[model samples]
Target: MARDLRFEPHDQPAGGWGSVRSLFRHATNAHSWSRAVPVLPKQNKPGGFMCVSCAWAKPAEPHSFEFCENGAKATFWELTTDRVETGFFADHTVSDLLGWSDHALEAEGRLTRPMRYHAPTDTYVVVSWKEAFDDIGARLKAFEPDRVVFYASGRASLETSYMYQLFARLYGTNNLPDSSNMCHETTSKALPESIGVPVGTVRLDEFDATDCILSFGQNVGSNAPRMLHPLQRAAERGVPIVVFNPLRERGWETFINPQAPGEMITREPTDLASQYHQVRAGGDIAVLMGMCKVLVDRDDEAREAGAPRVLDVDFIQEHTHGFEDFISRVRASRWDEIERASGLSRQAIEAAATTYLNARRVIAIYGMGLTQHRRGVDSIQMLINLLLLRGNIGRHGAGILPVRGHSNVQGQRTVGIADEPHLVPLDRLAAQYHFEPPRNKGLNTVEACEGIIAGTVDAFIGLGGNFVRAIPDRARMEPAWRRLKLAVHVATKLNRSHLITAETTYVLPCLGRLEVDEQATGPQIVTMEDSTACIHASRGVAPPAGPHLLSEPKIVAELAKATLPSNSRVPWDDWVADYGRIRDAIEETFPEDFKDMNRRMGTPGGFPRPLAARERRWNTDTGRANFKCPSSLNASFDADDDPAVMRLLTLRSNDQFNTTVYGYDDRFRGIHGSRMVLMMNADDIIRLGLTRGGMATLTTVADDGVSRRMDGFTIVEYNIPHGCCGAYYPECNALIPLSHYAEGSKTPAAKSVPVRVSAQP
Candidate 1:
């Protein structure tokens, strides 16, 4: 029988007044304030580890408090007073912990030592580090290297990532699947095909030169609050910021920067968007296509009258390929079809296009909403095409910005955490490590889950991250996780992933970025790459809460030492003892701009990675950036195919960052007490004969009859687009089938899922 789970609702006090009271109380209470701030060293020097929460990148500026609310929460949670010691695990069973909520489990506090689950006792028994490594090594040795998968999270450092990829290649497996494959894979896949580089081309300083900012599917204030300052500056300078989203997020409309004292004290906020359009979910591609088509038409008319084309014809002719093919498709497309599919009239599209035309420099910013659809790659390509219509590719203020989620996710890909069919890092590994690397393709996150379910994968090791709960098909995935021969997690705290134990499971505690890592060679520095392709160093100032806790680099090195044979060429011990040696290995293998990495990174305001932005060079095959045409202009899903189903888009709450739920309340969205409620258009709710606050059932329309129908969920009437509905993710992950994913990217289509809503029985 399924276990009964219940959650209590926590009510929050009203607005700015409540926040002021809480701040005052927190400051006055010595214990509260001290406990909140993680104990740190008195050094004025900045740390190497980037903030693991968001993608807002700024030079390491000197400030009283460099952390944000979510960053603070992450740090506090990592360096909490509570410790999940051997005694605690001995007292609780894995099954019991599995019944706990995600927030509650993490709140239980940090893990101190290595633990191994004993199935006979049905409890987690503490094990010595040596014994745990020996057992894990034996199990790993039993399987083929290709079958053994290694997963890395975005929080990993560049040195750690380099070492991990090196170890994997030596062990003979190309399956270096990571968190990026699920999030920004579309951007990485599409941007490079169009612009010759996979990263965003714009810098923060470029905003000053930009006349217009076209933002799509990105919620800046909530996701990356630091970005709001530049946006606020742009707005103040009379630059028009256009927003396109399925739902009207408050952050997009207005924002209050907590960093500014006057604004915080006065409760004054800055207006963000000049024009906000609530486009239908999955309709972004069509909308972009319409705007591009309009530009082409206008340019054609000017050219016909002996005037120069509105678009940069010289740039297109010189830099791009496939222009004629793209032009033919755009000319053949009808305005009526584009308007109907996009849910935007011809006049509105024309007005939007005019803004793009009038602006001297424009930046197009997008997030997961554009990349979590069936044709996500196509959608990304369309956005790139729009930027390329003008000479935007190699310009300062004009380019593409794919707002990444995890702080270091971009870094992970840069260091070779990929399942690329070609470009395997193993070839370099064989030369460096003197071992035959695995050549066979390995499983991605989704495939890894499937492998476990099919009983093909016996051992699972996660470097860091909430694997089971983060993936879709939760009901199916949780069971598969339990069947492993050995399940090992290197984590900072207790999460849902820890409880999913095997016959023999281990939880190895690791030091967080905020906590100081004491190595053989003294303090170690870690590096992370930002969204803008800037590689910077992070150093930990705070002492670790417990001495037993090890750094991620140390843990991986120890594990590799125990697993690899004596003949292995990789120096596992040397790499962990001093991170500079690891960086040297990276420099030798994949030689880039960071030659004297340590010296350059130590300089104030860490160095930039090798990007075309700094040089104004396009690394495409033709010596310039290429512009490709979108495959199709159709954006609307065929609702007639499933008449009863309503399209559902999964979202994150304002109080939350990614899968970590800091609280139940979403203050900005006006949601309180519950996360199970669905936001819908009031007109759509009334049209369907459903009353506000009414209970409803949402069924998936698929052939498998796998219906995740929730009956008690409250229906909320909100200002969403007519055909769209919204629900918080990880909770609504049950509704998304594994098969329903992006075509080229293979990322789960969490932004677009068809569901049918009905009154509760």
Candidate 2:
């Protein structure tokens, strides 16, 4: 399965001619494009299906074309005509299939029926859904609650996630860990401590009123294409978009609106960033602190001159605490240290800060680039500090926005799919369901993997993600999954996770967002919360790929009924029949957040959830927006100290979404027909004596005394910061150690792995 790797430097902006071509090609490859093309217009429409891609908010007024290239690709990929029937598995054994690339494995198409792994033949055999549930129930009944781990994915709806958490709690364990634990868990943990809320405070329409947008560490164009719309509009309206990232992404510089007829015909793309700064990997804290220093210094000068106060004095006195301590740390930070750590000159940082100070309304946007680091929590806090210092929060057109990757990852967390048992009030759950929910915190993604390795885990259930592929240290995690007594996955298509089997394995095929989910009552529509905190209903208009496929709620409820006793107080069957009942339970659990969930979802545009941070009503321990000052303002890594070791950042390709591979081509970054490639700085490539398109092996640097290496990766000279390199995730995830994580939030340091690259042996 050798691929002919191709690289062509792309000068055009993202979402112009290249995006249109790629969209059609992928849609055609998914099967008959004509049959699935109609589904695109319906996506993100009022009461229509939501894009399975990134969770950017659905436009208030639906457009004729509502989806981006990747969003269309997801709809087509799910509505693909290629079915993985019994014959497909019979022809390809699990051992044989493991050798295939991720694209090839999923390209075989949608799973048609429930499957059970027959270890003797090494092939998946067909099984009844009832039989599968009964088997899962038998295993759960045999094991202690603490020994079972329940995992959730971002692709799931809020209904499914609530059902999943409820099932896990009713089973007597709080072992609920989802995809959030891997990506934005740091934001979830740090924002509440800093600003009295877990999710971002800005509304979707705030982009229109924002005067300046400061983006940090995220490739906005590639990760969420729909976001380019608002950014483009902002740029056109004279809004200054200051971007800070390691690589020069085409999306950050310029983007073409595919919806514009003149632009599509002329191929004229709009410039996105007014000023772009290449902040080195793991240098976000330094860059942020430097910006804060400039702001504080300006504020001091303004006070001396008796001009308008620059530091939001009135707001600080009324709504904030610990600002004095934060300012002291910022003022004491030396310019030389900030410049050295941030890989940016003081002049550039000061200029950026000047823009921030001048703007009346500002929005700070960040992604995994800020979250996946050794000091990720500190980096997030520093960003919040900048916004707080200027009183950007709780105002019109200004706040903090964390760009969530998954469609409903935020919604899942909102509805109680988390490792922390106290995330949802347990007393309410117990009062409504008539069962005592567990009080102890449970295993998150990382801890769950460790628990499996330590032989403490007996059963593993995945709601809707490629957990093994998405998590770090696959060499250890994969084998640990095999040791589980039982493993269950509720999925729509075949993926690498299904191949990694346990003693008892079941793959229950479920409905995709674009497919109609007909239950006992009738067709059901699920609700999801977008990144901007808007809750909307998503109803599938197309027919199911297979008649046997069940909705995620049905699968979860059947399993609950099979596992729990007859006297179990939860109304699992009624909830499964109509999803409205599930929302009723959610309202009971989260009365303040989801009051009248059904009614709100019926509106043209869904209701916005209450954000205390938006109203300056702080929910922190101090009852004020707390400024968390770091002990030191230095970068986590030393650039001058480690010339031989380049920091490796794990990223997603333009054609990929999370762990799902749409294709091997990363057109925006000039990569083609390969996923096993690394992007390195030209200077570092020459220093390592490596040439473009040459093979290299990466060895992880750790103090644990064990060596982990990923062999045979092709290196490409890229426009990146010196001493830093980048590679796509799930491929480079193995090089990340589970122990290497942010101090407070245990998120894997995927973006900042110290690795030594050498010529392949």
Candidate 3:
């Protein structure tokens, strides 16, 4: 538990001595200070391991310390000396462990041995590796492949992800759902349709040449604090940085670089965002359209005045399609509708457009803020439309950047962790492995949860992550999880998902990040892909917590061997002995994307995977950059016209990453001790007849027959727009229904939940 739980104003700028102090405290909490000291300098280095946090690209020339506060916390949390061995599990039953908080369960430390659930005892008992593998194989053999679900998290290495997907495919099921389905699948779906690229186009070095940056819906200070260094540097260069979010994030407000001795001595900070607009949640499309409208209006004026054209007429005429229709749609969009839907004045939108037009080389960036909406795919497409108008894609120092979570999250998708069959190379995989892969479309995260609830999914094999806890509608998903006949989890630590056991459950312990992984061919180094599609190698630094722990590659190989027949197409044992064999296989499978991957693994800053969009090559059906405009600018804005409903947007604490809660304190937001607090505008608080610092209950206003409730949340006054509220995620996730998700992508609309808050009895 946190030392103290309280709320107070945080007046200091982000990432100065405050981050250093926080890192020191967290370092001490990693079992001890000395335990975390040795690995601090090695993180994000060439020969060292990648930080198991955000997917922010590593600079070619990294600083002395490449880690940020979030990275440090992740390092400490992973390397903690505390161990949850067989004795610990023996002492606590599954029912007893279910009552523990997420932070408390993780604080018990790493898992040291494989365990199997004993049904009568209601506790987990130690199981041999061979026994667990054989049983899981036999159980999987008994069920139809469609009844099984293979789930992976973003923390998985690209090699392991490739093997996992291959194993699932060879087993006659393409039911490969991963963490990306919930976060950046919208980007994956939208970008390719618009610009014929599935990933962002900007490189890390382009930041220096970028004259202006436009960011949306990302809370950098909490999710990716290391990004502030670049933002601070950009500000120092007098580059204009603009932001649009529902809340005024501290990272956008100001930042004091901890590495800069001058700033530390003077106690001064650099203002990051030159113009910060607090746009309403689910209003990204409206705001982006509003900006495009302003640009179009400016272009009309310029045409009348005979001055310079505001839009790139030649570029659009040559490289783009559907411009006239997109322009007509933007022109038809009324200012009153945009202003009302975006919770901003028309003048504010115009001012932001002026900033956009003033700069030649611009980069538009976003996070889950633009996604996780009813129209998430449309929202991202709208952003692409604005970028296309100015010909931002493939331009020097200008492109789109989607800040992804998890170190290799984007890499996982690149390596075949996807539900869509076309996104993965079927023929090449079949040719490489000498086996036919599953061709049918598989279930996504939400669909998998639905299948589990309906008893269609009888078995679940998780390579990593707490799937049951990370999804929406926990109240409904938990019981359905237990209904499964076989449940398997490959994890590093104990989590709630492990406690909700199936009739036959196995918890397999694997090596954590940076832990030494010795295989038949010396210590193995795994490769991971960053947000910018840069692929780099990561090697282990720390010793394994226990001898029983196996590397993910080894565990995956053994499982693959155990599941398949005596004569299998894959040489699982050989691949496990040397991960290089797997890389060679990947090279053959993806000749263009990972061309000569094995030889290039030793590059100084690693190598970039080929991206045709970076050179403005269109891979779309039309052979040109396509434009799309939604009929309405609002995303779930008119979801419910009920006057009592307020938009509930879930967020993460500064001390937290993804579903893992490191501490109760939210450093940037100034809340401590607990996560059960709802942030609301003062006027909305009064309108709802709620008092600041008082308790309230939130009930979802979903069309689904089921009801969701989040009870006893402390009310705190915030500067968010009216009719919108914010709450900490994984806790407030209870208030979101599984059915309420982005339409095309099926990504959980966790950021735009509609709920009503009232006084708690």
Candidate 4:
């Protein structure tokens, strides 16, 4: 079936009656509405399961309806009544499934049993669990210790991730490539250098007292709907909220508080942003520089006029180093250069600076829009600079917040999952487990792809996430991925990667976040870390989707038992029997972070891990906070002086989460039944000689001598910055080369890809 594309103007406020209807619709469609009647109230409450969607932090007290529209969609989808059983596989071939859309493939339902791909028939057949484990163990033993890549997703719980990393390291390899390498690798790399920690400084409750909020590179309404509550409250209290993005998002403009009874009946949404600036793609560095310049220039004038200084001299002198050099660089940045690069006039930047100066307690929040670029690290550091100028760290209602994508991505990293072996103190793990971990650095996401392409990697095992569809340059990676000797995925549902089979392909069914996981010690509980670094216990209340499915921790432990040496001291079976044993092991490994993790898990809101930056204690090399001084504002990508070239930004639609497409409609954007559409400014559409609904092909402007094109995309004129266009991901991911990444971080620059739009023949 061909996907039908439709377009219309969406002018309604985000998250009002529309969201209520969407939640009800998806719940019924997934056959989970009735189940949710009992399960929904249990979500995010104390000792309850957290939503398996985005990792937005929950409030201390839970409301009757704590989950958002997208959260409800995720819950219902995971606990759907439909099942992909043996008969379902008999009905569809891998070849036929390959032709279906991502949404269609997912809608086929959950996998009830383990499956293996048969090459001759190009179909997946049911396989016993023992056979699957034996095949995987044989393949792993056949390959060199370093020839296997153990990939993880943010969806993995901390207990699962810890066991995975320990198993890989004990097996004499550290080739752990994770979803974080593709998303917030910039934040993980940059924050430590600036603030002496790789985590955010704010808590969930700080939003209540914030005087100003600056949101950059994130669509708060669609991505993290729970954030809308705080944004709406800030707006109601007349706190200035500033938004910076290439496109004017509807959620940032106005939002209806779904929890409020009067607002839902009246449909009168609260106005959100006091100011919205459509900054050009990859222009965050320039905008930051412009804001800093305004502050520095104003401070100098204040000194001359005998007024109060704008910069926080006391905080800078007491806790920071390298201020003089940073101030000099900010002062030296010319307004013309800032204007040209940022695509905003000096006056507008000054207005934003005024808002920043007026607020003593400010919060700066950003998302992947800033981190998914070649200059991502620089952008993250620049935000810290802006916050540090006002002494925002360790203050009430003031700090830096990097909104992450996955539910437990930050937690996964916290529990020791990294490409760099040195990031975790291996001595503690080695002493605890009685094995020496690999000392050398391992392959990151890009390096892992290169290793597969070069045939240096023999086996690939994914704990979670759709690897092939989630990464960049699918055309290149998919073929390389298929050549691997062994491929195993522990997932709940069907996805594109499962269809892209290897020589020995196995799909092992695993329990979802909302399912029961029974072991010898009875039902188990898993722990996850939210964006704010709060570690909490999550107990699934719903029944298991399938009787045969295993928990993620169990799957990892069983795989380790099959592959590891017989004399290994890791106690895999014992940990699998009781997850409390896993938490005990985790506590023993990271004593400081999880000293009393088991006891703390019983706390009402759980416990927050130690954050050195939150206490204004510097843990950097110099024992003080450092201000980074990047030389140039120019992007890393090669750009021509041609005015015809436009930067293409791949963004998520309102109805989507990462690559998970819940439906065909993007209600917030007024887009229906279409994922193959480009959002362009009216002036840009006219300049390219294209009318609304006209077909166009987006060709990559790369010097690699290889051409990448996405064809048959309808053009939709939108309220976006000129010289920039927007499209959805996994569709436009083909146009991005794996080499186009942040220099040190190796994160794919998915946000800003230079391209040309031409009419399709």
Clashes of each: 9, 0, 1, 0
TM-scores of all candidate predictions against the true structure: 0.93, 0.98, 0.99, 0.98
Off by over 4 Å in 2: 1-3, 32-34, 634-640
- What are the lDDT figures for the candidates, one per model? 0.74, 0.87, 0.88, 0.87
lDDT of 2 at 592: 87
Per-residue CA lDDT of model 1 for 564-671, tens digit only, reads: 776646778888889988888877776774667777766544567777743556766766666666666643345635545677999987657777876665666777
Instruction: Name the better of 2 and 3 by lDDT.
Output: 3
lDDT (Cα, tens digit) per residue for candidate 4, span 1-761:
11487677788888888888888888877777655657887887787898888888877786778888888888888888888878776688888888998888888788889999999888898888888888788778888888899999899888999999998888888898899999899999999999998989888889989999998999887889888987887889999999998888889999987888999999888999999999988888888899988888889999999999999989999988888899889988898888888888988899999999999999999998888888899888988988888899889899999998889988888888888987887999888878888998999999999898889989999998898998888888888888999999999989999999999999999999888788899989999888888888889898888888988988888888788887456888899999999999999888888889988985666689989899999888878888887656654354737778888889888778888888888888888888999989999989989887888999988888877888988888888888888999877889998888886798999888888999888
Better of 1 and 3 by lDDT: 3
Please identify which of the two predictions, 1 or 2, would achieve the higher lDDT against the true structure.
2
Candidate 3 lDDT by residue in tens digits, 1-761: 12345888787899999998988888777684556678889888888889999989888788899899999899999989899977887789889999999999999999989999998989999999999999999888899998899999989898999999998998889898889988888888888899999899988888888999999999999988888887888889999999999998887899988888999989899999999999999988889999999999999999999999999999899899999999989989999989988999999999999999999889998999988988999999999999999989989799999999989999989889888999988998888778778899999999999999999999999988988889999999888888999999999999989998998999999998778899888999899998889998898888898999998988988888888765455888888899999998888878898998988875656789988888989999899999987767887647546768899999999989998998877878888888888899999989889988888989998776897887878888988988899998888777778888888888999888989899898
What residue pairs are clashing in model 2? Answer: none
In candidate 3, residue 207 scores what lDDT?
85
Task: State residue 66's C-alpha deviation in candidate 4, in Å.
Answer: 0.9
lDDT of 2 by residue, 1-761 (tens): 12577878778898988888988899888894755787777888786888888898887876679888888888888889889988988899999988987788888888879999999999999999888988889879999999999999888999999988888988889898888889999998889999989999988789999999999988887888888998999999999999999999989898888888899999888999999999988888888899999888888899999989888989999999998888878888999988878889999999899999999999999999888887888999999999999899999999999999889999998888888976778888888877788999999988998899999999999998898888888888888889899999988888899999999899999988888888888999899999999998999888888888888988998998888876456788888888998998899889888999988886655688999999999999999998988655543544457678889989889878888898888988888888888888888888899888889899987888867899878888788998889898888888898898877788888988989999887
| lDDT agreement of model 2 with the native | 0.87
Question: Residue 711 error for model 3, in Å?
Answer: 0.9
Candidate 1 residue pairs in clash (backbone atoms < 3 Å):
47-538, 47-539, 48-537, 48-538, 48-539, 49-538, 172-437, 172-438, 646-755
Q: Largest lDDT belongs to which candidate? A: 3
